[model samples]
Target chain A: MNAAVLLINVMALAGILVAFMDDREKAILSIKIAFKGFMQILPVTLIILIVIALFLGFVSPENLSGFIGQQSGLGGILLIGVAGAIMHIPAILSFPLAASLLEKGISYTAVAALITTLTMIGTVTLPLEIRQLGKKFALLRNGISFVIAIVIALIVGVAMEATLWQ
Target chain B: MAISSQISNQQNLKDWISFGIVLLIAFVFLKIYPSKTGSVIEYFWQYTMEMVLILPAVMLIMGLFSVYVSNNMIEKYLGKYAGIKGMFLSFFLGSLPTGPLYVAFPIASHLLEKGARVSNVIIFLSAWACLKIPQELMEFQFLGWKFMFLRLFFTVILVIIMAKIIEYFFEITDDRL
Candidate 1:
């Protein structure tokens, strides 16, 4: 198996072993929870996978780069950054999706911005966040997160470009 | 609580509908471009295999974390205090395998009520949202070590800065309130 698969399997094995040693009932309960969580996310995962396939199969690297490649400039970065802030998906799944976008000639900076904001800002969860943490706190956290996500992405883009070019 | 549950239920419905639409589109794409369908299926299969390998383990880690690390326990530890220690603790606790970012909001609110610094609470919330261990591992798997570590480092630094900025703004707003 590849390292990623091996690592994940080992992690699952270790988690099960630890839980079993700690409490058999809770261990079993954890497994049930895992299964439920998987089921809940499966539909979304399939949809995203299908979309990614379409994205890769149809969209050419040049076309993608024209929108968000190395020279796509600040506007392109901002656009994807906003898209990331607004779109809510499970963060773990975002990496693969982002990688696919990168493979299609989207700039690394754009992908970074997308992943950062996608994880940090949750437009869908804003109501729950405001309800729990107060309006100002929720708004500030998300708004600031968006700006920082862009900044972080640009930095990564520049750094990566420098290294890759060298 | 009722509103959140209602929202989540709506979200679930929306997701199902979207999935249905996506499936329909996939079918159409296959029919229209029989030759391209091979590439689409290939990409789909690759991602599906990767996801099948990782997602279950990720979910199990999250499940074990939720069961073992009670929110009450987190509240007791991160509720109050200030300074570098509190900020670091917030980042550390937030990075643990607990639940999603929404769940962290309640914990953060509790911490605020218990007199935790706003900066620390922001740190905690952001860390919980972005820096969970299992999520990092998945990112590592897909994005490579350079991307993963660089993004992580940048996020940590920027999160702190953002927290401090928000804290300052809130303090000004607090006086007015």
Candidate 2:
């Protein structure tokens, strides 16, 4: 199993066992609080979660590694961001995709930028944004996102490069 | 929909026309800026595919909003709250919301009818598209925190600037639609 799943399952089992051990009322109360928190946020988050899930289902994380990540380092980094701008990986699948890519041969930098900026840098979504907002606003936001994504990716890349490349 | 818009079914005719023009501009741009890579198809595919999932959320959220947040409710909660509170309130609401960007427009129009300013609506819709926090969080978990932080920072700043620009244009044109 993936790290996320393993970690979540461990937490779930522990929480359930602990709750079962505690007074039923107290455990139920805590569960209620958790449910409330989820309700508060779920309205907004559910759709994004589903979309990300669907995206990962279709696109193999493995393909991403093959295309933009290989061993090119800096070039790969920029390419990933560029690819991300065009592609659209939801939040849910991004991790698994990243993990899978990294497992194969993607450098941390390229994967980082590609995954981060994928939604923000959308060439496809640009038309929609422009339709909703204006051209100038869309351009500014996208441009700034691209620049910021590059900087963040570089920082992550450098750190990973030092550790992994050597 | 305009007959031309329907017949042509080309919402972004300008995009196709200007795409070639933009190609030339890119040539000029490269001379000045010098980019490392030379293709955007992969990136295009990425965003397009992501939207595949987002589109349904758009329809669902649109229906939800239409039902839950009525015209009167928008006027009461969202009206006259235009400065920082308005900005943040709308920002949060927009981020949390899931639907097509247009879904918000009708509600905005209703609020405007009830007295919400265009600036507020523009900011709200813009933030809705950019400040999508739930999506961002999932992205962070999947992609990592680094990607999330940068996107949030840039999206916030971009929203602010775009909001102002939108406010300006609407002010000048008195365009409500």
Candidate 3:
């Protein structure tokens, strides 16, 4: 296993031990909650896995680069930003997918846009946000997030390129 | 509670249906490209194993946070503070990795209703959406420290500014009303 995975596992184990030492009942409850969460995420995780696999398997790097590579410019970045805003995959899963996209020649700007919008804006959960927060608050938050996501993407794109040249 | 459970059940069913559709698409594509089937499955298995290895740990951490850090605790602490202290507290509370962004909306609304500063509420919600600890760790692992740190830095500064702008707009609009 990778160091990240191992580190996480060790932390989890230590946490569980502490929790159990503190309160057996709460520890058991935590485990139950974890199991439920695992089950809840499993379906979506599997779907994303298959989609990523197919994407890597079927799409040629040249085609992917043509669509969203460094040369694709701002238009491609905006397209991906919109996609990220609408999609509902788990943020953790998105990182590996982003890494794969990077490997396939997608621009850093597009990938940053994707991650930012994916995490910040939730088109699917808009109804819930509106219901809980006021219409103005929800709309402003989402709208401002979309704009900032693009800005951040551009900054990251420029900064990473500068570092590479250095 | 009954209504919410029903809605959740419906959501679960929708997810399953979509999963099935995606699986069918994968099967069809593999069938069409017989030679590529091996590579596809190989990639799928690789990711599945990677996710499986760490997800339990992540979920366990989340579960502990959910259990130990009650919503009442957040409300109590966040509603009492103001100024820079409040902003930092909001950021800290929201970055706890307890649940998804949707789950945080009600809490944020509650905080606002209880007279928490508008800027803090915005900071809290934004932090919850993008700055959870576990989520950042995963990003660091997959995307490298530089990419992760740079994004985090930019997001923190930009989100605070955005929050202040929104709060200022709200203050003016409330006065007009």
> Among all windows of ten consecutive residues in candidate 2 chain B, which has the lowest summed lDDT?
B35-44
Highest lDDT: which candidate?
Answer: 3
Q: Over the stretch A1-166, how does candidate 1's per-residue lDDT look in tens digits?
A: 5787688779888989989998999999988888766766777788889999998998888877778887889999999998988887878778889989988878889999999999999998898888788888889889999999999999988877785744
Q: Candidate 1's residue-wise lDDT over B61-165, tens digit each? A: 878877787778778878754688888888988988455578677678778887788888889888898899888888888887788888899999999999889
lDDT of 3 by residue, A140-161 (tens): 8999999999998888888878
lDDT of 2 by residue, A1-166 (tens): 3443344335444654565586566555545544433333333233333333333433455666556654465666777788777764333335445654554566777766865576446576566556655665556556756776677677666665564534
Per-residue accuracy of model 3 over B1-177 as CA lDDT, tens digit each: 343456556777788899999999889888888999988888888878878788899889888888888888999999999988999999999998566688788788889888898889999999998898878867876787778887888999899989988988899878311
TM-score of 3: 0.95
Displacement of residue A79 (Cα, Å) in model 2 is 2.6
In candidate 2, position A49 carries an lDDT of 35
How far is A28's C-alpha from truth in model 2 (Å)? 22
Give the fraction of native contacts in model 1. Answer: 0.76
What C-alpha lDDT, on a 0 to 100 scale, does residue B129 get in candidate 2? 50
RMSD after CA superposition, every candidate: 1.9, 13.6, 1.9
Grade the docking of candidate 1.
medium
TM-score of structure candidate 2: 0.45
DockQ of each: 0.74, 0.06, 0.71
Model 3 residue A44 CA deviation (Å) reads 0.3
